[model samples]
Target: MRHDSATLIILLAVVALIAWFAPDVVLIVFAGCLLAVALRAPGVPLARRLGIAEHWGVMIVALVALVALGLLVWFGFATLADQAREFSRAVPRVLERAGTLLEGLPGGDWLKGQAQPEAVQPSARAAANFALAGVSGTLGALGNALLVLLLGLYIGADPTLYRRGALALLSPGLRPRGEATLNAMAHSLRGWLLGQMFGMAFTGVFTFLGLWALGVPLAALLAILTAIFGFMPYIGPVIGAVPAVLIAASHDTSLVPWVIALFFASQNIEGNFLTPMVQKQSSDVPPALLLGAQALFGTGLGFLGILLAAPIAAAGMAALRVSYVEGWVEDPADTDEKRIIRPA
Candidate 1:
């Protein structure tokens, strides 16, 4: 018993050290797990219907998704390409207009000074370094994305293999509880993903309609961006709103407030209405906990950290409930009335 405990502690310590030293790898793995869950969500049902293996279903789903994405790009590429170019052109204009507007306000000169690039030009060496860094960053991002997709596909193909491998790490006595905790975590993650998808769809549709109504250019592009960004909670919506607000401000100063109001309304509806409705069927991760996790992970891991924070928090909460709360805190002997009664 003592040997098992010691082994578990050492294992945990080794895992923690790896996480601390190589957070990027950890983030990539977590992202792959998330993608696997997403693939499995549809794949499982399809497998049952088609009387095929789950892994085969997952493969089929992945192939179909890739084909659909290719078709979408083939069809929508021209319009999106045009809008993207227009968006790029509009950004500089927006910044210039913003600088002008800032100059008109009190303390605007100081703000503009702070906001603008430094007057001093960079040296050749510095310029080269900056360009190198940008290229490296872009390449690194693409590499990481490809790795994530491959890992996700591999894991989604045979999730049970990974599950059993994980269980193998635990003692025989603890494997059942560990498996239960893992299942709970998976359930929580799935729920969070489902809720996020719904929220993103809701935000996208409403944003496009509202932007179109308000005569915003690149409504489709902006809406797609907003939907994509909606995956990250708290900070995402705000970031998503920035391009639209900037474009609106540049186009017609009057449109800015309306654009802001539109996003505010959409976010409120999604947060207050859609999210709660979905949370009813899943574990409810507290807003404070989620925000705290975002802060911690974002500080440590940057953008990917923020993107995965909510689902991590959800899974963490689920694991706690199963392993700690239900395992020890709840008294099987106590009746509902007894549980509710406070000590005098």
Candidate 2:
């Protein structure tokens, strides 16, 4: 027993070291696993209904997704591209306007002085360097995304292979529990992903309509950003709202209130109505814990960390409950009810 505990500690230490050294790689692999779960979540049931193999269902889903994505790009890419360009051009003007507004406020003279050539030159140089770095970073990110997609497709096609490989790493006595833990983790992650999908879709569609109704510039771009960021929970919506509010303030001060109200309404609906329905059908992560996880990951690992934080927290919670709580603490013969994590 002591030897086993030591081995577990050593293994954990090794994992920590690897994660510290290659955090990006770890995040990429985790993201791929998440994508795989998403693919399999619907595919498995479809396969059962169709009397087809699971892999075939996954393949069909992948193909359908690709086709849909291609169609969207074909039809909407030009408009989105134009809007993005306009948004980029508008941002500098918005910042300039904001600076002017700030200058009109109390302590404006000091703020104005701080913006003089001495401070501006270094910022300009930094911006140029950042732009250059950004190009390479974007290319690298695209490459990483492609890699993740391919990995996801492969794993989704034959999850059992990977599952068996993971189980093989454990002792024979521990393998059964490890397998169960893995199943629970996957269930939790799938539930989280499904809920996030609904939230994102709802937020994006409503936000776009609201912005368009208000005649806000770059509605499409802003909506897309809000939807993507919706994956991150509480912090995400706020980050997504900043640009929309800035643009609205710059375009027309009157429109700012309406834009803010639109986002607030969207969030209220999602938080109060949509999220509860989803949680009833899936695993629930406490809001406080979720936020804590987001902060920890965001501060430690940056954006990719923030993006994957919720699922990681969900899976981690599921594993602990299944492995430690149930295995060690719970009385199996007791009639007391316990929450079970399951896929929606």
Q: Write the per-residue lDDT of candidate 1 for residues 1-344, one digit (tens) a residue.
A: 67757766776898899999999998899889889988888888999999999989899999999999999899999999999999987766777777777987999997776545442346899999999999999999999999999998999998788989988887776665567778878887877888899999999999999999999999999999999999988779999999999899889999999999999999999988897797665758777888999999999889889988888888888877765676448852342432221100
Candidate 2 lDDT, tens digit per residue, 203-247? Answer: 999999999999999999999999999999999999999999989
Residue 67, model 1: lDDT of 98
**Alpha-carbon runs more than 4 Å astray in model 1:** 1-4, 104-107, 114-128, 330-344
RMSD per model, one decimal = 5.0, 2.9
Residue 221, candidate 2: how far off, in angstroms? 1.4
- Candidate 2 lDDT score relative to the true structure: 0.85
TM-score of candidate 2 versus the correct structure, residues matched by position: 0.89
Q: Quote model 1's TM-score.
A: 0.90
> How does each model score on TM-score?
0.90, 0.89
lDDT of each: 0.84, 0.85
Give the Cα error of residue 262 in candidate 1, in Å.
0.6
